[model samples]
Target: MLKNKNIILGVCGSIAAYKSAFLVRLLVKAGANIKVILTPDGANFITPLTLATLSKNPVYTQYFDEETGVWSNHVELGLWADLILIAPISANTLAKLATGICDNLLTAVYLSAKCPVYVAPAMDLDMWKHETTQTNIHQIQSFGNLIIEPGDGELASGLYGAGRMAEPEEIISFLDHAIKHSMPLYGKKVMVTAGPTYEAIDPVRFIGNHSSGKMGFALADELARLGASVTLIAGPTAQKENQILTRIDILSAQEMLNACTSIFSEMDITIMCAAVADYRPKVIANQKIKKQADSLVLELEKTVDILATLGKSKKANQILVGFALETHDEENYAKGKLAQKNLDMVVLNSLNDKGAGFKSDTNKITIFNKALECTVFEMKSKTAVAKDICTAILKILK
Candidate 1:
């Protein structure tokens, strides 16, 4: 869940400050972009050089560097992070945080942060049980900060009690669960179809479109980003995804239909985005046809409509979306498909418009909802287009 996330790791003064190094390494290994902010006292427990090397970013100790004359913009740092985590938070820092103290860069960044803040407290058993410290923790929580409760174990004070910082692995798992549950599409299951399905006529001959599966891949990635469990069913294509998702590969339209129908009933949302072959050769030659004839004639038959088949079985709670790639009368045709196929929405694309067709990175789309409400968008990169489409879907979900 932390993949590609911008995270600020705050290390405060505590013997547990040493564990921040392991946390930084784990976060980086999980594909997070890490920036370490070390308190002055934290530096005594763990050197800035050690964290800098582990995080692969320059560690921030003070707000300003006297020798280099460079200033670290606390507000910018705060805004850049998706989340801020304070590990090994000391009683002193906890008190400072609850009272809005901004004496250090870490506190200043916390105050300026617009994103979620998480803290893992580490102190002696007496300090953890102290009334003042508990009050401070309550105040911080009242302000919307989350606390990863300290564990029960031996502390630096040589007394065993509930004051040990959470282990690095535990902290990571906590963050992942917290972040995943907070997402808008959490627990939703989505299915997307992409690319062009090929219809085989002979061993060496087949028919397929020029779809690159860029838009479909982008949509799957976007849905996954929103925390939806996405299964991408793709036709023959070289397209790849950045996010990890369940992917099923197929070549023919029949294969695509079988795949979609087998799982369509279980999907909360199904997007039919593949450019499937409308017609296929009626007869398939067992072996390659020899070039012995001057001309050849092949009869064609309509391929099974995967979208309509799924639409027939779609539950009222399930959303079914289809795409219409047209050369003319795009809006009417898209609206027709939306109603005729029992689709919740139809995304229209016009091949007549430059940069809006198969194999292109850019596209112009017009979305028609079940109510026939139309939303037209300008030509944009497929990635941005995917976001727009996902936003529309979210409105319906809401």
Candidate 2:
């Protein structure tokens, strides 16, 4: 859930500030862009250089650097973050946050931030349990900030109590659960088919299209981002998903069909985006044919229409989508497929459109809904197109 997110990590004065380094590493490894903000007191426990190296971004220490004469814009830093996490938040910083004190850059950024703020408090047991501190915690929570409650363990005071900072792994898990729980497609099961199916004529030769699976892979990633549990059924392609998802690789249309049908009933949404072969060689040659003939002919048979079969068996609550790559009469063909195959929607693209069609990183598309209403989109990168498509799906669900 943290993938591609811009996060500002706040480290404050506390012995637990040492754990912030581990947290930064975990966030970076999870594909998040990290910016660390260290209070002057925090520097005493952990060096700013340590966090800067782990986060791969310059650490913000003060509002201005005396030597470099560079000013850090706290407002811009606050606005840039998707989330602000204050780990090892000392009692002093927590009180400052609750009371609107901006003595330091970290507190100033917190006050300027509009994104979600999560704080993990770490202090002595007596300080944590103090009535004033409890009041500040409540005040912070009332201002819509989340608190990752400290764990119970031995603290810097050498006394065991409930004042230890939560481990880095625990904090990551907490963030993921909090983010995903609020996503639009949270708990939705999605299936996406991608790439070009190959039909074998001989052991060494086969027929395939130019599909690179970029579109389908993009869709899978976007759906996953919306918190859906996605299963990607892909034909032979070198493409890879940006996020972790269940992937089943196949080499032929038949294999793709079998894979989809087996799980179609359980899916809330299914997108048939693969360029499946329409015909396959009727007879498989046991050995390579010698170059003895000037020409050759092979009988071909129609492959099963996987999308149509799924549409026929589709549940009332399921949303089935298909794709149409047309040379002429694009709208008519797409609408025909939308109705003929009982699809909820059909995405149309034409080879005539430059930067579109097979193997391109970009595409121009028109989406037709079950009501025959069409929405045309300008040429865009596959990733942006995926977001648009996913937004359309969300509208339908709404």
Q: How many steric overlaps are in each model, in order?
A: 0, 0
- lDDT tens digits, residue span 1-398, model 1: 99999999999999999899999999999999999999999999999999999999999999999999999999999999999999989999999999998999999999999999999999999999999999999999999999999999988989999999999999999999999999888899999999999998899989888999999999999999999999999998898998879999999999998898888888999988889999999999999988998999989999998888888888899999999999987788998998889999999999999999899999999999999999999999999999999999999999
Angstrom error of the Cα, residue 111, model 1: value is: 1.7
Model 2 over residues 30-115: C-alpha lDDT tens digits? Answer: 99999999999999999988999999999999999999999999999999999999998999999999999989999999989999
Question: For each candidate, what is the lDDT?
Answer: 0.95, 0.94
Q: Pick the candidate with the highest TM-score.
A: 1
Name the lDDT of candidate 2: 0.94
Per-prediction TM-score: 0.98, 0.93
Q: After TM-score superposition, what is the CA distance of residue 34 in candidate 2 from its true location, in Å?
A: 2.3
